[model samples]
Target chain A: MARVAIQHEDFDLSNEIAELRRHDKRVGAVCSFVGTVRGREEGTHGPPVLSMELEHYPGMTEKAIEAMIDEALHRFDIFGVRIIHRVGLLAPGDQIVLVAVTSAHRGQSYQACEFLMDYLKTQAPFWKKERTPQGEQWVDARVSDDAAAARWGIPGGNG
Target chain B: MKIAVRYFASIREAIGQGGETVETRAETLAALRDELIARGEPHAGALARGKSVRMAIDQVMSDEAAALREGAEVAFFPPVTGG
Candidate 1:
């Protein structure tokens, strides 16, 4: 399978992690992050989100993510990497994204996983639109996310 | 020269289209954007100066000062919110 996938299907996290470490005797650490759609935000009185629509720049989305994985490989001692981002209509509590990395040690695995996620947050070409009782609106980019990526020395949070 | 331009999310909604091919003499993304803005209406407003439109040339994130080449693919949209 390709290292990066932009799909509409919900992924099985365990299966993905297993696949990453399959047949690799030297692999000792696997770190992963899965992001899900939140129906409601904490301490906010806004209408609860009913669904989310994800839009992406097709060919560019996949290519951008693949490049990110390449960068991660170069910066870390990771052995395997898999990133999957789901698109289309999704209900609350649905999984939207997954970033999994495999390495020989916990340090490399952990760092690579976080690095990939921070990079994806600011650099990927995907846009999210939330649907609520009030109406549907495109999600705004957060400055904090930009800062998160910049902490890794990759500026331009795209926000 | 010819180039392809794409829009996403809110910008796509505002412009009422996803992408288009344009023929122009503009040498860079900034010049091309100015030319499109001259077309009036949504193009002028959605891609107006001071807007939060981010751009990429040939699928790589870049600044407006980056020179354009023939058949290059360009994109314009708001900041990305994806994780």
Candidate 2:
């Protein structure tokens, strides 16, 4: 299976996990993460988000995520990795991203999964724009995401 | 040298296009950005020094000090908000 995919369509986690672990007898643990669109802004009393538009640099997005997965493989003894990130317009509750990892143990898979996610959040070349009653606005990068990625000792300038 | 300049998100919107090819004498991304800003209008405001802009060279996240190359694909945008 391809290590990374940037699509406009939604993904099925079970299917992806199955593909990642297929024919791999050494795999003893599987860990996955799904990020979905939120309906409301954190501090805004404004109308809830009606929809969101995701934009990404096509070539760069895939390359960046693939590099992150490579880093995960190097840092953690993982067997396989798969990441899918959706683009285009999406509604509230729609799945935005997925990261799945397979390893010989649960601990490694879990750490690798979170590591890929943290790196992707700040490094990947994707941007989100939300539509609300107040009109449309581009989402800003969060400082917390930088802190999250920093825990792994990588600088996340996205903040 | 000629380079491909791409924009995304707010930068793309503000610049009114996705990308373009331009001939430039700049050697670094920062110099390239300053050259674009010298064009006035949207380029000046969108790529102003104080704005939080990020750059990529040949599809890799890069710093302003990164040197430019002929036929390079360069991108300028805001901090990413992806997951």
Candidate lDDT values, in order: 0.91, 0.94
TM-score of chain A of each: 0.97, 0.97
lDDT of 2 by residue, A42-154 (tens): 77775799999999999889888888988999999999999999999999999999999999999999999999988998899999999998999999999999999999998
Candidate 2: list runs displaced more than 4 Å.
Answer: A43-46
Model 2 TM-score relative to the real fold: 0.97
Docking class for model 2 is high
Q: Which candidate is the best by DockQ?
A: 2
Chain B of candidate 1 vs. true chain B, TM? 0.96
Across residues B1-83, which tens digit of lDDT does each residue of candidate 1 receive? Answer: 99999888999999999999999999988999999999998999999998888888988888888899999999998899887
Candidate 2, pairs of clashing residues: none
What does chain B score (TM) in every candidate? 0.96, 0.98
What TM-score fits each model?
A: 0.97, 0.97
